[model samples]
Target: MIRELYRQYKDRWLLELTFDRLLRWNRWWPQHRDTGGLLCWGSDKVPPDEAAHTWQGAAYESGLDNSPMFDGVPFNTKTNQLQLADVGLTSLYIADCNALAELAQVLNRPAQAAELRQRAGTYGQALQMLWSEEKGIFLNRRTDTGQFSDRLSPTLFYPLLAGVATPIQARRMVDEHLLNPAEFWGEWVLPAVARTDSAFTDQNYWRGRIWAPLNFLVYLGLRNYDLPDARKQLVDKSNQLLLKNWRASRHVPENFHVSGVGRLPSEALNRSDSFYHWGALMGFMSLLEQDKAVELKKTTD
Candidate 1:
């Protein structure tokens, strides 16, 4: 988002204003959430009476409230961290370090840029260790038993966004997982969980519902690779989902049905917010693809 803001507005002042704060946030993850060098979703020590301040607080920190990924996962009361080395959080932190490094260079802070780059590399290597060659995707590891969580979500695709996946690994992930009809790909592009997963039938928030932000983030990850077909399919389907709901009741939903069943916002179940602004990201994907097409045409012409 900072990159897009700078691209459109060239606002150095805004970047400068957020750089130090972002740096602190980047550091905070490793400091507070680090579990053997890989980060987990966690909270600082809070009063016991604080609502959602325990395991639920860690889930909230993941921005994936009630995702099945956190289901039954243990929390370390001693550390205030989930007992899982989250692939999503680790990949995102690597991406964050890379983005902060770019911003540091843009702001003429060479030392900070170098530091951020080094951090990215360290975390990137650690994230790569999460990959399951047998599963053809990265899985979250239980910090307690050192077992990989079989529960899969779009968050697993984030390694591509972090630029940590090799091209061959990316291809395998896209082919074996992302495009699998029984999993993510279908009438709807990407569901929060694999369709075959038991949680998918729940059709609940972050369980089986389709989220625009998840689609958008996965789309960005696709852009990092040579997967043009997957990328186009995602953009087209996301646009269709947005337009279908928008034309029906002028609603942009926080999420959509995996089966493409829901239309009206009022019809949304499982606390899916109707008319949420981030839902517009579904349409934004199309707009970005359109821009890319136009740029390609110009170059060809």
Candidate 2:
């Protein structure tokens, strides 16, 4: 399956574009870990397959609010040198770095481990300071308005779930942001940003939708951090949400509302671009594996 997926994706346009998005850093690029370290941040609201949304991936594009430049970090693939591109939202680095760290640990790659550690440090510093406690979320550090995005999003969970924060950091973060009954436990936690935060709206797909991949990140992040009970609860709840949706709509929708209502299926192309879209399946199966979650339907709503 791995070999087939590689063969299937290797020379496609998406892969071409994906490869083009690698780090453009001048001297700080790694020579060993480039394959995993993204040279650019992903678009804000668009799924990987769409090009019309934030348009912020790998190129020095015509539009983008490049920011939060991470300096002097040193994880890279052997094929590539230092990777330097526009640093994206805090969540991006945390999730990727944590995954990198795990891959390093599992593969017994010491150099990659060192690089992942340094990158995690930079990401942690950013998350701790960047979060506006009053708002209970991390805002995009764009140059515009000099104001925060004014939303509590799934992005915040990435840092904690990705193994970027220490235990103290995780506990504080979970208490303050996630595990809070008032917020995180909602019908599945409203989509990315909270509805009460002046940023919530039904049409704002990402801002309020309950995305599977993001939830998966939370489950995996908590599991990686050794919060067994917390991880179990989240995994269980997330699975409940998925099964609920699967039952209602025979087919698994890309995402759901905080209300647990499935959204209309997207009409985007490259439906087969697993990495680019339909990442929700990955989340569902992940939780299912851990919690013995069930699939209630095969036909999507």
- Candidate 1 residues lying further than 4 Å off, grouped into runs, are 47-49, 261-270
Per-candidate Cα lDDT values, in order, are 0.88, 0.48
Query: How accurate locally is residue 258 in candidate 2, as Cα lDDT from 0 to 100?
Result: 63
lDDT of 2 by residue, 7-54 (tens): 456434432343212222211333322223333333223365454232
> lDDT by residue for model 1 over 130-216, one digit each (tens)?
999999999999999999999989999999999999999999999999999999999886899998888998877888889999999
Instruction: Name the TM-score of candidate 2.
Output: 0.56
Give residue 149's error in model 2 in angstroms. Answer: 4.5
- Considering every candidate listed, which one attains the maximal lDDT? 1
lDDT of 2: 0.48
User: What does the lDDT come to for candidate 1?
Assistant: 0.88
Would you estimate the TM-scores of all the predictions? Answer: 0.95, 0.56
Give model 1's clash tally: 0
